[model samples]
Target chain A: MESSRTILTKIFTDYYLGAAQAKKDGKPIAYVTAFTPVEILRAMDITCLYPESYAVVCSASGKAGDMIGSSGMGQFAGDLCSYSLISLGMDHAERLPYGGLPEPDFMVATNNQCGTTLLWFRLWSQRKNIPLFMIDYPTGSENTDQNEYVYRQYLALIEFVKKQTGRDLDQRVLAQQAANSRAACKLWSQVHVLNQAALQIDAAKLANALFPIVAARGTPAVCRYCETLIHEHSRENENAVIAAQPSFRLLWHGYPLWFLPKRYPSFNDDRFQIVLNDYTLWWDLDYPAADTLESLIRPYTSTYLNWLPQRRIDWTEQLVRDYAIDGVILHANRSCRRALAHVIPLRDHLLRQGIPSIILESDMANPDYYSPEKMNSQLESFKESILAA
Target chain B: MTAVDPILKNCRSMVLNPHHRRAYLQSVSARSCGIIGYFSNYIPAEIIAAAGFHPLRLIGCFGSVSGPALCDPMCSFVQDFYATQCSGLADLLTGLVFPNSCDSLKVLRQVWQTRPDGPQCWTLDHPVNTDGPALLYLTSQLRRLASELAAASRSTVSDEKLHAAITEYNTIRGLLRQCYAKVEARRLRYSDLLAVATAGLMLDRNEFTRMLQEFAGSSLSQPLSGNPVMLAGPLTDDLELVGALENHGACIVGDSVTNGWRYCSQDIATGGDIYTKIAQHILSQASPTAFDLHRPSLAARAAELGACGIIFLNQERCEPHVHSYVKCAAELEQQSIKTLLIEVEHGRPGLQARDLMRIESFMELL
Candidate 1:
């Protein structure tokens, strides 16, 4: 009869308790990323945190609006990508509220989502004085007949990990982990499919997505969490919404989901269900490794970012269709130019494809760059466009 | 077309197209006027269109399109003007436009923000269209600009006129989108697009539209070969650059640059919900590459645009995009996407020929 919050408290406590143990043992507790995958960092028993999740935490609250405008956020204002700003803004912000950069033995970053995060991480790690490991990704453009390049990165990552930990990764264990992660993602994808039709996004279900969509990618835990989320979604009841989801369903592109949660959470009502997010989709697809530790870092086993040029367009088109999403909201964040870089073209692309996309402008971590009331009005137009359609 | 067609060389003449003088320049000639625009992307296309004056891309070519001048930083193509010193393309163009993008373009604004011997140049002062201080500042600025433009043109933009202007602008946007779609699908070559984008120089929406619509209707077929080169370098890849690619039997396909995609949008609605339209347009235009830091970083969107191989171009000593080009090269390399980073400067003709030969070699790989 333990309450859900109580159970979550326990889970969080257990993880943190485990974290406390690592702290006691002087083992590093680095913040890992869905920018790459969960298993790569988990393999070494390092305490991991997903900035994507922290971004979500800010998304559910109005905290992100306040968190922006830090000196670090301003440094990247018109230069890097918005997600980098979000990660940096939040990463730096977390140090103030959630305590400074977590103590970590080593830092692992990836070039999966446009090398911005990797670049940002390089700067971040350098500033932190931590050992930095990068997982090279395959080019996302025209392919050479050689698939070896893709998997080559996987092997490289494996070697890097092994060198750092001084313990060779067992191929059998890595394959098992990959299988589990992929299975979890499949189920996560299915759960996301449920609310594809403007179904209301249940908060609990969204919370559950963290596991399969994020934590459990490349593992059975993802599938289990997805199934549980679906069950929880079915049992949920909502009457406040016009139907179950909003009249218009949308996806918040880039890192502003965290920045503008308070401004636009109204869209999360029962009338419309936003079943997927760029943040969630990235990790679910970019599981860094599959077979042996060496095989995992193979260049052919590239990241989602550099594996194919049309990957974002492909992903966006697929998500809009899969989720039957009506529109896209590009968080034209100031700091993370990388995230917002192609947003206009993507908007243009979506517009050409007849998707009603809107760019929601704001600084992911800087309040000086946002207007809640005005943003709400803009979203209203977006929502109205959905209703009108 | 010669071995190197004059894209950057005659950019100013292209901007100051006679139509602009026959219409707007007569007015500017009669009386002084303030001008505002972004260096490369915006380059006062719409403003020139509205003011009935000539709008220029401001690209410069060294005496020979043969050298490193073409490879200067992205902004160097227009705002930097190292080539203007030699090419003398600066004679036709006057004034500047600075909007929010990268630090390189922003600094250009500072340089012009206090020009003592030029047209009363102004900054549009538009920020990203998001709901932040930038938006608020830009909203106020837009209102001021509407009035300023009216004063400059000596014709107040009535609410009706604004609405019509917006719709007309939207038409241009729709047409541009059509062209981009064709480009995205690889149906059109970048060289074919040069005329259309060039037509925007000093041409009004109507004239540019006529040229664009004609091209859109016509069948100007160019093939993108096996090695569909996706290049990012200095400001060399202008219309002239596109033509150069086409001349070499390479179709300029997709691109990831401030002016390439970030600049796409219809005119803001003239009347109701004007702020929203302007907001959206500005936000869409402020993609990552807009800001040019000394060592700028790669935009994820560039990585998202798949090309067989990437060409990183930069102007020597440009500072910003050069660093960005290097970082982008490393990133592209990590993805197993081979990259050739080229450095160029204004007034240098020999370097461009070598770069072209080098490009031919790189294209051979794809």
Candidate 2:
């Protein structure tokens, strides 16, 4: 029987290979941002690829530095989003990974995640001379207005995909896909809940387990992968003997440092168990089945990073309480300004709530920004503080 | 030393000193219902004007102020705004409007709302795509903003008031175009042109128009001597960089910056549903670095200005302009046009020695 980690690796590998093959077979391939409506593309029978997820894979594989250097040769600034740099650099790179991403037939990006996606996809569109469709999600606005605005874009997106691929979207197929996405989200949520009950799962493992949900959320494969993930965790929870519990059960508050999977202290240490991360819960939303497109507006627009800081504070407090989290680790990801901007206030709020949190500054995909000496020192001090408390 | 025109001197003082600008707004606030502050060029000042409130563009402040510390990686423009707000300069305004222009500003808006005694805040959701649906959505957003502004000021925005405001701004835009043409023709100094443009953000539209009229009527046509260059970037209020470039033998003949030409390059059309027209005008303008598509060709603009090179200026930690520079630089290279990239920390007092040396070298290269 394949381990959950093996299954996740295979799932991502197969997806990339299949996409490369699909491009050769003359199938339409669309590079999409993480929070885009991939369900629509799936229902239309178009191959959807997430450059962001693939960038993470490249970072984990230790090839992101070369790719970033290639991008720099093209005059892309070193401070731009590392995920974008990785994708942009792939075109100029000498060695191709996974046969390189298929030249996008078209690109779809939603600003629900961050403003960087729009710019990154625009660069791709310009480079490939392909049509790019943007789904705008206005932050810090009224919910009704945001919903109406985003829902209108969803309608427009359908027309755009049809125009690009010459394929009509079947509403029934979309409904089924949305159903699968909802099921996967529910199962993923259960995994979080299960982790809260028993800290038997490794956070690094869970981060890899998140690929299916992030990349293929509206497909049955995600639902199956999530179920398998829940099963594995449940089995561990039941069969494992209670040894020495971790001294500190911490919650990570931003994107994981994908390039430093093995060296990340929380993953390597037994005394510190990273029980929850904000990244894993980003897609743990329950969608309503009544009106698929209309319903997507609320959950899609109201992503954790998309909300006001107070809502995130409240949600973090809830997670800390529910998960019995002892301390918090805030990854002040330099590449993600939207996420980084809210960290200080969040740290202050957590401090006021009597919750100890430490901020680790590093880029998600760029290893150049990661000072292992500094990180290890900070983690050592943080562990001591946690133990003292 | 050159004799500075009184109007230009007044504009320069108002732009260079935040206290002077604040005092001016305070005096204006006493005469008007209230002052409404806005950020970004995408915000329609006509609506704020229609509400009988003074529309002041917050171009940020110099140096840091005592405030809740934002992270170091946040853009300098946002940091400067927080400095201004924390310094109590923003207290003169009754409300503030923040356009969803960039990620940093969007985060600032959310964080600003968390303040207990902060002024009434409204967000204008600018769409990335400039199409029919986007126009409709933006129009709706503008309508909502108009209603909110009216409600805050306890007034109404009649079509007549809106049209009047539109005409006043259109006059300002036309006058600014004349000033830009003078600068491009090398008859006017870029610093003086910049002072006029920056002052417009702080001054009443009518007063700004009068100031420009006086400057335009003056026979100040002295062909400035320097290597002609075009400055392009996102929002910046670094008045000294313009002076620094000229000091190093580079005359900034034209600009695509938010605080410069992009502010007054397009005028809202009259004789229509004012909201729709305002939306259309904003969408049709050369899209800012924040917007995803329809970016105006910088190389073509540089060629039209007859610039020997293009100076791509970016604020430190500004991701949008940095990303834009990559594409624009490639395009300029293909055109055999020389380019220099300069990143400055906004609100810093002066240009770094390294940057000055780079500017000198770039000037020599051109």
Candidate 3:
């Protein structure tokens, strides 16, 4: 049987190659944010690509520095979101993975993840002279009006996709896509639940498992990949003897350091096991079963990032209890201000609850802002304090 | 040399000192129903006034606070606002209305709500598009804000009251435009024009209108004498940058900042549903960098203003303006216009020596 890592790599490689071919074949391709409702585009046969995921690939492949430098030459400030900087830099980048993403026919973005997405995508829309459709997600408490607004925008977005691609959305295909998304999400949630049972899964393996969920959520490939992940974890657990539980279980509370995936192993040792991260659990939503257009509104609007800080704090405390997490590692990503804005208050809230947490300041895609020596020293001190507690 | 008028002098003092502005707000709040603070221009000040509350635009303060940081990498404007709130402004205002405009302000709203004793807070969600559906959505948000304000102030917003507020604000906008005309004609200094506009945000509407009417009609001796340049970017309360620009031989003929022309360029129509008209006015104006993609060209505006160069004064760590500057600078360069980009830190007392040197060089190029 093929390992899950190989399966994921194959899935992603095929996806990117297919996108490139679609560009060559003159098919419609839209650059979309990760939080956009892509199933609607998929139903219309419009190929959707994620610049945010592409940026992560560049960072992991060690090409982000060059791309970021190119962006600086274009006058984009280094303080802007590194994901956006890398994506913008790709046009002038000397080296590109997959020969750079094909020029998008159009762009779709949602502000649910961050406000920077709107600005970043708008830059492309203006530069390319392509139509850009924006979906505004109201931050803070959810109301019926907010939900209704989002639902109507989804309807409008479907029309926009149709107009851009000259393809009609098939209701049947959309229903099937939603069902596939729900199944994959269920399986992904089960994987996290399994990790809670046994602290044996490595953090890097889980991070590797995030690609399919983020990239292929509305397709059957994601369901298959998630099933393989579940099977491999269970099979490995059954084959080995009872695993020794680590002394400390830590929860990663923000976006992963994509530039340093290899360093995740340093976290899984005799003293600590990274039980879970909020980034992987972002899509573990209870998608409605009806599979109607209206059904998607709640699931899309109710992502963890869209909630207010208080709600997020409550959710984090619940996760700590549920996973028996000993401490938290907050990634104060310099590139992402929206995510970083709530970190201080969240840290204070956790400390008041008798939970120890430490903030690691770095950029997810830009390694220039990250200091390994400083991060290591902070981690060492955090470990001693957790052990002392 | 001519002596400064008392009205302009008071406006200048208020702009230079936070204490003077706080005292002015206190005096105004004592006579009015209450003072309601708003963050962005997207917020309808008319609605707050119609609710019998004096609307004060909260241009954040300067300097650091002596507490744990609320957020890192936040624009100095928002940081200073949070610092001021932490200091005492939270208790001084009846309520705060935050437009869901930028990421930092949105998160700051949420963080403010986590405080049990924070002022009554409301968020006005803004739509990035200006189509019919967006207009309808924004109108709905305006109506929601009206209801929120009414409940807080215990006063209703009637159509008559709203129209009256609109007319008063429109008058203020007209008077400010006349003042800008003086700047264009080189009859008034641009720095003085900015101080008056900034003071207008904090003063009572009626008092500001009367003061501005007198200033606009008064004869001025000091004339602007330097190379004309248009200023564009986000909300900047840094008067020092303007002073430094003019000191280095640059005339600020016009601006596209939210606190300047963008705030008062258009008047809300009084014929239609008041909320819808307010929505249309906001959506019609040149959008702030964070709000819309299809913004009116700053280069075109600079050309119209007869300025040879543009000074893009962006607050440090402000993502929207930084991203917009790249595109705007490119467009301006294509048009054979000179441009200078200055990233200013808000809490800092004055312009840095390097920034001053850059301004000087940019002026020389013009």
> What 10-residue stretch in candidate 3 chain A is worst by lDDT?
A235-244
Over the stretch B119-146, how does candidate 3's per-residue lDDT look in tens digits? 8888888887777777888889998888
Residue B135 of model 3: what lDDT?
80
Q: How does each model score on TM-score?
A: 0.49, 0.95, 0.96
- Which portion of correct inter-chain contacts appears in model 2? 0.61
| lDDT score for residue A253 of model 1 | 69
Ranked by DockQ, top first: 3, 2, 1
Q: Which candidate should be chosen as best, given lDDT against the real structure?
A: 3
DockQ of each candidate relative to the true complex: 0.02, 0.61, 0.64
Q: Say what the interface RMSD of candidate 3 is.
A: 1.8
Best by TM-score: 3
Candidate achieving higher TM-score, 2 or 3: 3
**Poorest 10 consecutive residues by lDDT, candidate 1 chain B:** B65-74
lDDT of each: 0.51, 0.80, 0.81
TM-score order of candidates, top first:
3, 2, 1
- Which candidate would rank higher by DockQ, 1 or 3? 3
Q: On TM-score, who's better, 1 or 2? A: 2
Ten residues in sequence with the least summed lDDT for candidate 3 chain B: B286-295
